[model samples]
Target chain A: MNPNGQNAETRDGCAAKLDVCGLDLYYADFQALKNIDFRLARHEVAALIGPSGCGKSTFIRVLNRMNDLIPSCRVSGKVMLDGEDIYGAMDVTELRSRVGMVFQKPNPFAMSVFDNVAYGKRMRGLRDKRQLAEVVEVSLTKAALWDEVKDRLKKSALSLSGGQQQRLCIARSIAMQPEIILMDEPTSALDPIATGRIEELIGELKKDYSIIIVTHAMHQASRVSDRTAFFLLGELIEFGDTREVFTNPVDKRTEDYISGRFG
Target chain B: MKKRVFLDGLLYGIMALSLCGVIAVLGYILVYIFRQAAGSLSFGFIFRSAREGGILPMVVTTLYVVVVSIAISLPVGIGTAVFLTEYSGNSSLVRILRVAIETLAGIPSIIYGLFGLLMFCRFLGFGQSIIAGAFTLSIMILPVIIRTTEEALKSVPVSFREGSLSLGTTKSQTIFHVVLPSALGGIVTSAILAIGRVVGESAPVLLTVGLSRNIPRTVFESGRTLTIHLYYLTNEAVNPDDFGIAFATAGTLVMVVVAINTLTKILTRKFKNSQGDAS
Candidate 1:
C-alpha cells in the first residue's frame, strides 16, 4: 500500500476489484512469493515485470487458483476479489469464472475456432445456439480478431497462425465475461509483430476488463500498463504508476532492473 | 578404421540374416496352411454348419466373445486409467493397481481358464456359455486396455488440462472434452490390442465356452470360438480331409485378424476427422 492510501481508493470510491494482503506462497518447503501487499482498482492494467523464476507468473496464477493444480503448492494470504476471500469462501470453479487467465502459450482447445471461443459459455450451461453464437461474435470482436476469423469460425483453431491463436485465447477468456483477466506472459512465444498486436489488444481490453499481465520485457510493461510492479527473487521490489516506476523507481533493485542492469 | 568397417559389415549381415529368418518362418506357415487348406477353404466351408463341414458357428461365437469382452472391458479399463492419471496423485493405491495389472498380464492363460471354469461356469452358474467366456476374456484383457490407455492419457499435453480448467470447466468436464479426445488414438489402439487377445485365446475359451457345434442364439448358449474349433479339429484329425479343415480354420483366424485390423484403421481415421469437427 502507498503512504497516501491511493492504491486502495478507487475513483468511484468502491472497494478495489482485487485487494491482496500479506501474501506468501510456498511450494512444499520452498517459498515462491514473499509477504506482498497489493491492490487493483477497476479497469486498470497492472503489469508484473520480473526476470525468470522471479514469481511473476506464479503471482498471476494465484489470482485464479491455477496453482491448485500443483499438489505441492501451498498458499497463505488474503486474496480478496471484490471483498470476498477467494481462497476461503468462494468455490474454485466460480472464482475461475470470475477471474479468467491467458497462459504464456496460446492453448486453444483442439477444436473449431467457434467452439474454442464458446467453450466457457457452453460449459456454464448456455445451451442456446443463437446465444452462444452471439457471445462468440462479441468476444472475438472485442479481442480484435473478428475480421480475421469471422469467415473461418468453423475451421480448426490449430490452423491459425501463432499470433492469431493468442488472440483467440484472449477471445476465449472474454467470452466468460470475467471481471479481471490475468495474462501470464501471453505473448512471450510470439514474434515481434504478434507481440505488438497483443500489446495493442491489452490497451483496448482495459476499457472493459481489469488486466494484469506478467511480462519479462520491461518495454512491454512500460508500453501497455497503467501500473507496474517489479518483482525480484520472489519479493516485490517496487509498485507504482508505470511512468513513475520506469522514470524514477523508489527501490534501488527496481532501478537496477529497469536500467538494464543485472536482474 | 578398416577393421571397424569389417565389424560393422559383419554385424549388418547377422541382422539381415535374423530378419530373413523371421520372414521365412512367417512365409512358410502361410504357404503351408494355404496348400493344406486347399480342400476346405471354400465359401461353403466358412458359411455352412459344422455337420456340413463348415465353421460358421465358431466364427459367430468368436465375434460374440470379441464384442462382448470389449464392451465389458473398455469403459472399466479407461476408468481405471483415468483414476490412475487424473485423480490418484502419487498414492500407493495407484502403484499397487499398476503392479497388479502388470502381474495379471503375465499370468498363464491356463490359470485364467481354470479360474473362469470355477468362478463364471460353476459358481456364477453361467455354465460354459458365451457370456461366461466373454466375462473371462474381458478380465484377461483389462491389463492391456489399462496400460495402453494410461500411456495415451499421459501423452496428452498438460496445457490442455490447464486451459480447460481455466474456463471454469470441472475436472470431469475437462477430461471429457479435452484429455480423452486428445488421447483417442491411443485408446483405440488399446481396444484393438484387447481384441487381438480375445481372438487368440483358446484354452480359456475351451474351459468356459463349450464345444457346441451349433450357432449360438444367445449369450447363455454354449458355443465354441474359431480357435477352440481349430484346436479340436487338429486334436482329432483322422484323415487328410480333417487335417485340411484344421488348417483352413487356422487360415480363417488369420483372415479375421487382418480384416479387423483394416476395419479399425478406417474407423479410427473417420473418428479422428469427426472429432476435429465436433470438439
Candidate 2:
C-alpha cells in the first residue's frame, strides 16, 4: 500500500500473487513484448491500459498460452501463479482450466442459452442432467442474467441482444470456475449501459476470482479495476493502484497517456 | 443508369432465352421418347430383359454399378476434401495439391475410362468387369466431390471456430462438432449432384465395363448400366422392340434423377429444422 492507500510497484506488499519476470514475446520477426515484468495479486482486478498495437492483448494471451496457436509466436521467461511457474512442465490443458479468457466480442456458441453456459462443464465430461442444470442456473445468476433468461433456456443464444450475449459469455467463463479470467477489451464493443452492466459484473466477480483486463478506456480502468498497469511500446511503464495511477502517475508516458497527450 | 439497366435487361433476356432453348430440347426429347415407347412400357417390357434377354437384369446391373461406385467414392472423396480444406497447412505443398486437384478436374472422363481400362482391368486381370467401371467412374467424379465439399466447408464462418476455441475445445473437436454440421447442407447437395453425374454417364461405362446386358450378381462380373444399354440399343437394333426399350430406359433414367433431387430437398429441409431447434 502507498501513502494514498494504494498498492505500489516493487514490493511484495500483495506478496507477488502472479509474477511475470523478464517476460519476452515475439511474433516471427516482430518483437511484441520486450523483457516485461509485472505482477497481479489474488482477487485483484488489474487493468492494462494502452493505445492500439501496444501489445497489451499479446501480453495477457501469454498467461493462458493462447498465443502458442500462432505458428510463428515465441514466448520466454516466467509467468508464475502462486509460486508455481505456469510455463514449466505444466500441462497446457490444466493451465487453461485455471486461467480462462473472454474476447472483445461476445462468442456464444451456436447453441441454446442453457447449453452455452453448460459448455465448459460438458467439455470436462460432466454428463448428468441435474448437475448441468444447477451449474447453468448458478453461473447465470452470478453473471446477473438468470432472471432475464430463466424462461427461455432452450432459445438460441444468438437471439439475445449484444449486452446479454456478452454477459452470457461472462457467465460461460464463470461456469468453468477458473481462478483467473483474462478479458481483452471485453466492453469495447458494447454501449455505455451494457458497459456499465459488465463493469458491475467485474466488480462483483473480483471478490472470488482474479481478473486481468486490457482496455482502451481510461475511465473504465479507474472505475472498475483495483490496480492499473500502464504500458507503452510493449513495456510496462507504470503499475500502481487505480486511483493513484490515474491521479498521480509516475512515468512520463503514463502521465502523457492519462492526460490524452498522445499515445 | 438507363443505359446500364437496358444492357442488364438485354443480357438477362439472352441468358434466359439460351436456358429456355436447352429446356425445350430436353422437353422435346422426353416427349418423343415417351410417345414412341409408352405402349411398349408394359410390365413385361420393363420386368423383362432383351428379347435376346430380360431388361430386369440390365436395370439391376445399373443400380449395382451406381451403388458400388457411390459407396467406394463417397468416403474417400470426403476425406480428401476435409484434409485439403481443414488439416493441410498453408505451404507450397498445399498449393501444389490445389493445382493437382484442378488438373484432375479438368481431365476428360474418356481419359479416366481409358486409364481405368488399361490399369485396373488389364493389370488386375478383371477385364471389362463392373468393378473396373466403378473404379473409372469414381476417379472421374473425384474432382466433383472434392471441389464441391471444399467449397461447402469454406462457406462456414471463422467465428464459429473462434468461439469453440475460446471455450478450450481442441481444433479437431471444433471442426467435427460445429463446422461439419453447418456445412451439411452444401455437402448433401454436392453428393446429389455427383449421383446425377454417375447415373447419366455412358461413354466411360461403355469403355471400362463393356456392354453386357446381364445382371451383375458379383462385383467382379461384367454388366451394363442403363445409359450403356440405351447406347447399344440405339446402335444395334435387331428389331423395333430394341428401339422401344431404349426410349423407355431413357424415361426411367430421367425419373430416377428427379426422384434423387426430390429426396435431397426433403433431407436438407429436415436437417435445417433440426439444426435450428438445436441452436
Candidate 3:
C-alpha cells in the first residue's frame, strides 16, 4: 500500500481506474461477452450478477487475461488498469501478478496452508524466509483465516473445511499484493456459514484493493458490493450503485433479475 | 426359484472359470520353467554364456534395451499424453492425432520390427546394433506409454487444475506441480509395462540388435538379449547341455520380469498413499 493511500501512476491515469470499453470475448464461434463496458474505481468493490451462461465469469477472467489460457478463446477492445492498457506493454506474468483471481471452487494448492499462501509471493521472487512468513501471516489474517490455521500452518490445505480452503486461496492471491482481485463466483461452492465468512472478508478487502466479483446470487451482490453490473446473454444490461440497481433498477431485465420474476 | 438358482450358478461358474484359467496358465508356466531349468540353475549360468561361464551379457543387454527404450519413450509419450488430455483444444486436429496414436499403438511388434530394421538399422545408418534395437523398442512401446499416460492424466479431476490456475499460476505450472504429481503413480505403471514389453521382445531385437554373443559396451554395439539367447538355445542346441541353458535363461527372464512388476506395484501403492496423505 502506498503511504498516501493512492496507487502509483503509470503513463495513463487509468492505473487509478480499471476501464473496459467495447470489449467482446469469444470461444471459437460462440460469443461469450458482447461490447461489455464497465469500470472499477481504485479500492472499490464491484459485483457482476446474472443467470448461468450470462458471461459474468467470462468478464472477470478477461480482466487478468486468464481467458487467454483457453485455446480458441479470443478477445477484442481494451481493459485498462489505473489508466494503463494492461493488455499492452505488459508481460503476462507481470499482469497476472498485479491482477489476482480466485475461482468459483475453492482450489487451495495440494501443498500445506503456509505454502499455499506463500506460493504467489515466491513466484514474484520473495525468497527471504522471514519476509515470506510475515506476508503469509498478514495475508491469512486479511482473509480472516489466520486464527483457525495459525496452529496448523504446515498442515495440508486440503485438510481444511470448504470455507477455510476458499479463504486460503484468497490469502494466497493477496500475498502477491495485487492491485485488483477478480473473483468468479467465489462463494458459490461454500455453505451459508462459509459464505458469510467470505462475504465478511470481501468487505474488509475493499478498503485496500479493488475487487470485481461475478456472482449468480443476487442477495450476495446486494450485501457486499458497492456497485453492481447486471449482465444478460453476453451483454451488460445495467451497472450502477448496488442499492439503486437492486431496489430501483433502470432496466427491465435488471429489475426482473433482481425481483425474481424471470432471468 | 429355479431360474434364480440357474442364473446364480451360471454367473459364479463363469467368473470362477475365468479366474481358474488365468491362474492355471500362470502356474503351469512357472512349474514348467522351474522344472526345465533345474539342471542349469547355478551362479555360472547367471554370470556367463552357456558356452563360456553364464548369460551375464544377455542380462546386461536386456537391461540396456529396457533402460534406453524407457529413456527415449517416457518423456515424448507422457508429454503427448499431457497435450492430449490437458492442453488440447477440442478440435479435429486433436481428434486426428489421438486416432493416429491409437493406430500406431495397435501395430504389431513384428511390423514394428520390420520398420525398425528398415529405418533405424538400414536407413538411419545405425546398423544392426543395440542402438537400433533400442529405437525399435522405443517406437514399439510409445503407444502403450502414451495411451496409459493419457488415461492417467485425464483421470485427475479438472478441479485440481482449476484450483492451481485460479491462484494466479499459469497452465504449465499447474500441470507440472499438481496434475503430474497426482498421476505419477499411473505414469510409472505405464513405464513398467513398457519395460516388460521391451524385455520380452525377440523379433525386433533379432532384426535390429542381431544375435551376437559378444557383450556390448555401448548402445551402438551389437548384442543378443535373454529372449534371443533362449531362442538360440532351443534352435541351435548342438548338445543336450545347451537345451538346459535355454530353459535356465527363460526361467531367469520370467523371474526378472515378475520381480520388476512386483516392485512397480509396491512403489505405485506407496506413492498413492503418500499423495493421499499429503493432499
Candidate 4:
C-alpha cells in the first residue's frame, strides 16, 4: 500500500495535498521552526495546536511563503505543494493565490462587502461584472455569510460585526478557489459564539478544500480537525488521527500538554 | 480637596483667559480692517482696472500663481511622499532626503524670495513674471506637502497591506488600490495646507511676481499678486483714502483663503463619505 500509494502520488502530486520534510525556519539568529515533517491530505482538516511561540503560525506561513515578506526571515528543507517546490521556480504571488490565508484578526479591506469578497479575483484581473457578482455570491454563500450580507453588499465590510467580518475574510480566501487554505488562529480573537460558528464553517469547508488551522483551543482541535499535530519548541511531537491523539497515550510531552500539565 | 479644586479652577481660568485673549486680538484686526475698507470695498473697486481703482489684475495673477504652482508641485510632492513611505523603508538615502526636506521647510521665506529672484527671475530668465513666481511657490510648498502626505500614508493600518497582499496582489497594486485610497483624506488635507502657505506668502511672490499694475494677459507677462499689491498699497500710499484701498485688498485676500479652505473641506467630506473609507 505504501509503495503503490507513493508511486501513484509521485509526479505532479504529493503523498498528500501538501508535504513538508525537515522544514527549518529562521528569523535572523532565532530558529523559529527547528525541523518539521508534516503532511495534509486532500479534503481533510489538520489542526496545529501548541502554546504561544511554538511556531505553529510560522509553520503554516511557510506553506504559502508568507514569510518572504519579512526581511529577517529564512527557511530550509522542502515544502512541496502538489509536488512542486514552493521556494524554487514558483512565483510568490502564484503560490499565495493557490494557498490563501486568513489572519487571526479579521482584516477585510475598507471597501464594500461585494468588493471585499471579490478582492482576490479582482486583483487577479477579473473585471467582468456578471462573473464577479457570481463569484462573490457563491463564495459568500459557501462561507455561510451571503444571507447575512446580501442586502448590505454595497455597504462597507468594516460595518459588519466581528463574526461576519471573519466570515468575510474566509469568503475572501475562498474567492480565490485555493487548493489549500491556511488559517492562523482564525477565531482566537472572536467571542465564544463567533468561534463556534467558525468551527462549524471549518467543518463544512473541509469537504471541498484541504484546510490547515493553527488553534489555541484544545477542543477546537478535537472537534474540527481529523488529524492533530502537537508542536512544541518548533518540533512536531505527535501527529495522528485527532481522536487517537486526544484519547490515547502518545509522547510524554503530548500527553502532558493535552492533559493540561504544561504547554 | 479644597486646595486642589481651587488650583484646578485657577489653571482652567488661566487657559480660558489665554484663549479669549487670542480671539480678541484676531477680532480687533478684523474689525479695524472692515472699518477701513468700508469706503473702498464696493463692486466697482473690485471690477474696474487697477488704473481705474480696481485690483482685478492682481486677483487674476493670484489665481494663476495658486493654480499653476499647485498643478506643478502637487503630483511631484505626492510621488516623492509615496516613494518615501511605501518604498524606501529606512534606508540611508531616505534618511538624507527626510533631513533635506525638514531643512527646506525650516528655511526663512525671505531666503526663498532671494533664491527665487536669483534662480527663476534672473538665472532661468522668467524675469519676474507669474510663471517665475509659480515655479518658486511650487518649490516652496514641496516640503510641506511631502511631510504631511508621508504622515498620512503612515497612518494607514498594517492590516490593510496584509489583507491585500495575502490575496496574491503585487506590492504596487496593494499600495495603489488599498493603501493610497485609504490615505486620500490626509493627502487632501496636506494640499489644502500648501494652498494656505502659498496664499499667505508675500516676500517670494513680491520678488518673482513683479508689482506690475497692468492687467497681464499671459503667465509670462509680469503681474502682481494680491499680497504684493497689498504690500505696495501700504508702502506707496500718499493719502489717507489710499489706505482704504489697502484695507479692501487685505479683506479680499482673507475672503479668498477662507472660501478655498471651506469649499475643499465640504468637497472632500462628500468624497470620503461616498467612498465609505472615511472611518
Candidate 5:
C-alpha cells in the first residue's frame, strides 16, 4: 500500500501511456481548453464526460494533433506519449499513427470495405497483398465486424448500415495497431443496440489498447469507463475513479452535473 | 393570402416562359442549320479536302487545335486549382490571386488572340501556325478549367480530408488519391466546355492560324479551323455555287457542340451515380 492509501501496484504498475500536462488550447482568440493535467495508463479506459462545447472533443483532438488541420487553432502545452513530448519531439504523422482517432460521425472512406481497412497500412508503405489481407481480417475481427462483412469485402463501405459503418471505422483505426484510441462521441450517432455493442467492444478493447472516450451520456461514462473526468466550461472539474466521480463527486459542480441538476 | 398566391404563380409562370424561350432559340437554330445543310450532307463532302468538295482539312485542323490546347491547359489549370483550393493560405496573396483569376476569366478572347499573335506568331517566329492557335486557345480556356476545378475540389467534404489526414497520409497524397478522383467528373466537364469554345472560336484562330485550305502536316504548319473556314465561306463568297457546303459546315459545327454538351451531361450523371453508390 502507498502512503496515499492506494495500492501502489495498481497506481504505478505501468507508466502513463499518454499524459497531457498543463495543456491549454485556443482557437484564434477563443480559449477552447484551459490548463489541463490528465493521464491514461496502459490498458485502461478513461471517459471524458461533459456537456456540449465544454472542450472534451477539443481535448481529445489535441492528443493526436488532429487540430493541426484547423488553421486558427493553437496549443501551448506538453502532450507526452511514453514521457516524450509529442508536440516538441514527435512527428505529427508518427504521433497520429501511434494515437488513432474515431470521430463522432462514422466516416468510412468512399472505398471498398477491404480498402478502408487496408488504408492505414497502405499509407505506411505496405504493398504486399497477402500482408494487407492479413491485417484487414485481423482488424475487422478485432472490431467485431468480420462476421458481418466477411462475405462482402469488395463492396463499398457506405453500403453498410450506420452501426456497421462505425465498426468499420473502428476496424480502420485498429488496423494501424495504435497504442491509444481516441473516440469522440463515437456512439452518439448509433442506435441503442448499436451503442450497447460498441460499449461491449470498448470493454474488450481496454484489455489491449488504452481508450480515451468523450461522451455526452453520463450513464455511458459510468458504464464503460474505469476512470472518469468531468469537464465544465473548458475546465477539468474532477478526475477520479468512475464510481467516486458519479456517487461522491468532490466538486459541487461535478455533483450537480452527475445528478442531472445542470450542465 | 390571395395576393401572395397570385404573385407566386406569376413568378413561376415567368420562370417557365424564360426556360421555354431558351429552348425555343436553341431548337430553332438547330432546325434551320439542319434544313439548309441536309442537301449537301455527303460522305465525300465530310472526307474530302477543302480544295475538293469537302471541309475535311478544316475539320482535322480544328481537331488538332482542340487536342493540343486541352493537352496544354488540363494539367496546368488543374494544378493551379489544386494549389488555390488546398495549399493556398488565406493570405492577401491568395486573395489577389483569386481576383486575378476572376479577371482573367472575364477578359475578351479577341485580346487573347492579339497577345498570341504578338507572342507566338511574330516574336517567336512560329508565324500563323496551328501551334500558335493552340497556345492562344489554351490561355483563353485556362480560367474556365481552373474555376470549375476549384469549385469541384471545394465541394469535396472536409471530413474526407480529415479522414485521410487522421490515417497519417500526407496532404498531397490525400489530394491526389481522394480529392482528384472525386472531382474528375467536373474537371472533364470543364475540359469539354473549353473544347466547345475552342471549336467555335473564329477571330482567335484566324489571327494565329491563318485560313489555309490544306490540312496541317505539323504544329508549325498553317491551317484553318472549321470556324475560320465558315468565316471565309461566308465573307469571301468563295463559290456562290457552293452555298450548300457552307451550310453543311455550319451543321457539322453545331453537331460537334451538341455532341460535347451531351457528353458532359452523360459524364456528370455517371459520376454522380457512382458517388451515390459509394456514399
Candidate 6:
C-alpha cells in the first residue's frame, strides 16, 4: 500500500510528475482556461473529459508549451514539470522532448516506418545504426505494432491502417523516452476495434509513463483513467477518482455531462 | 428552367470553343515552325560557330545565361520565401515584401533590360557580356521563383509543422526535412517554368549581351543567345539563305522549350508518386 493514504490501486505515493498551479490561458482577448490547478502523479493515467470547446485540449497543450506556437496565445501561472517551472526555467525544446505529444490525427511524417520511429533520436543526434534499430524495434513493440510491421520497416508509414498509424505516432513519441505522454483524442479518428486496441495499449503504457489523455468519450475516460477531470466553459467543474466522478459527481454539471443531460 | 438549361449549354459550347482555339493556335505554330526549319536544320548548323557556319556560339551563350541566372536566383528566391512563410508574423514588412515581389513580376522584361544596361553593363562594368545578361535574367525571374516557392511551402499542412515541433525539432529542421520535401514537386515545376521564361526572352538578352558572333570563353566576354540570333537573322533577311538560318534558330528554341516542359511534366509525376508512397 502507498504510505500517503491514497488508494494503492490508483496512485503511488511518489510526488506529482506534473503540477499546474493557478494556471490561466488566453487566445487573444478570449480566456481559454481559467484558474486551473491540477496534479498528475508519476505513472498514472489522468483523463481530461469535456465538450469540444471546454479547454481540456488547451490545458494539455499548455503542459508541453505547444500553445506557444500561436502568436496571440498567452499563459499566466506556473506549469511545473518534475520540480522546474517549465516556462521560467526550462528551454522549450527540452520541455517538449521530456513531454512528448500524440495528436488527434495520425501524423506520421512522410517517411519509412523505421525513419518515423527514429526521427526524434536522429534529431537528438544519435548516429549509430544499431542503436536506432534497437530503439525502433522496442518502441514499435511497446506501441503493440512491431509484430505487424517488423517485416516492412522500410515501407511507407502512410500505407498502414488508421489504427496502426496512430500507434506508429505513439511509438514515435515513446522513442524519445519522454517522462509524460499527452494524447489529444488519439483514437477519435479510428474505428471501435482500433479504439479498443489503443485503450488496451494505454493500459499497458501507464505502468511506465505518466499519461494525460484528452477524450471526448466519457466511457473511454471511465474505462482507462485512474482519475478524471471534467471541464465546462473553460472551468474545471470537478476532478476526482474516475469511478467516483462517474457514479457520484460532486458537481451537478459533471453529473449532467456524464448523464448526457447537457454538455 | 428551360432558360437556365439553354444558358448552361451556351456556356459549355463557349468553353469548348475557347479550348479548341487555344489548341489550334498552338498546333499551327508548331507545324509552321517545323515545316520552315526542316530543310535548313543540319548537324553542321548546330555544331559550327556563327562566323564559320551556324548557331553554336548562340547555343553556348544561351546555356551559360540559363545556368548562371538560375544559380543566382534559386537560393535567394527560396530564402526569401522561407523567411516570409516561416519567420514573419504577418507583419507589415512581409506585406511590403510581397507587394514588391508582385511589382517586380508585373514589370516588363524590356524595362529589366534597360535597368541591366544602366546597372550592370555601365555601372557594374560588366558591359555587354554573358554575366550582365545573366544578372538581368535573374532579376526578371526572381519573383516567379519566390511566389511559387511561397505557395509550395504554404501548401505543407500545419499539422506536419506542429508534429515536428512537438518532437523537439527546431523550426528550420522541420522546414528542411518535412516541409521542403513535400513541396519539392511544386518548387521544381516553378524552376522549370522560370527556365522556360529565360530561354524565350529576346529584348533583355539583346541589350545586356550584344550580338557578338564569337563563342564566349568567360562570362565577361560578349555573346549572342538563340533568341537574339533568330531576331537578327530575321531582321536582316533580304534573301532565302538568311531566312533559312532564322527558321533553324526558331526551331531550335522551340525544341528547347518543349524539352523543358516535358522534363517538368515527368518530374512532377515522379514527385507525386513518391509523395503518394510516403503519405
- Alpha-carbon local distance difference test for all models: 0.91, 0.83, 0.85, 0.89, 0.87, 0.89
Best by DockQ: 1
Tens-place lDDT digits, model 5, residues A57-100: 99999998899988999999888899889888678888888898
Candidate 2 local lDDT, residue B36 = 80
lDDT of 6 by residue, A77-190 (tens): 988898799999688888899999999999998778988899888888989999999999999999999999998887888899999999999999999999999999999999
For model 6 the local lDDT of residue A98 reads 94
lDDT, candidate 2, B106-181, per-residue tens: 9888888889889888987889988988888888788888889889999988666655666676777777767787
TM-score of each candidate?
Answer: 0.92, 0.84, 0.83, 0.91, 0.91, 0.92
Query: Which regions in candidate 5 have their CA more than 4 angstroms from the true location?
Result: A1-10, B1-17, B237-241, B258-279
Candidate 3 deviant stretches above 4 angstroms: A1-16, A27-31, A112-114, A125-130, A146-156, B1-28, B31-53, B82-97, B122-126, B156-174, B236-247, B261-279
Q: In model 5, what is the error at residue B270, expressed in angstroms?
A: 9.1
Question: Can you write out model 4's per-residue Cα lDDT over B39-85, one digit (the tens) per residue?
Answer: 99987877789889898888888878888899999999999999998
lDDT winner among the candidates? Answer: 1
Q: What does candidate 3's lDDT look like per residue over B135-241, in tens digits?
A: 99999999999999988988888777765665556778778878898788789889988998999989988999998787788999989899998887799888877
Better of 1 and 2 by DockQ: 1
Q: What is the TM-score of chain B alone in each candidate?
A: 0.91, 0.86, 0.90, 0.90, 0.90, 0.89
Q: Which residue pairs come into collision in candidate 3?
A: A14-A82, A14-A83, A15-A82, A15-A83, A16-A82, B48-B54, B48-B55, B49-B54
List, residue by residue over B1-279, the lDDT tens digit for candidate 6.
Answer: 999999999999999999999999999998988788888888888888776777889889988998899999989999888888999879887899899999999999999999999999999999999999999999999999999999999998898888888988888888887888778877887798889899989998999999888999999999999998888788899988778778988888887777767877887777655544422
Model 1 misses residue B201 by how many Å? 0.5
What is the C-alpha lDDT profile of model 2 across A160-227, one tens digit per residue? 99999999988888888888889999998999999999999998998788899999999999998988
Over A102-167, each residue of candidate 4 has an lDDT whose tens digit, in order, gives 999999987889888887898899989899999999999999999998988988999999999999
> What's the CA error at residue A37 for candidate 6, in Å?
0.8
Task: Give the poorly placed runs of model 1, Cα more than 4 Å off.
Answer: A1-8, A11-14, B1-39
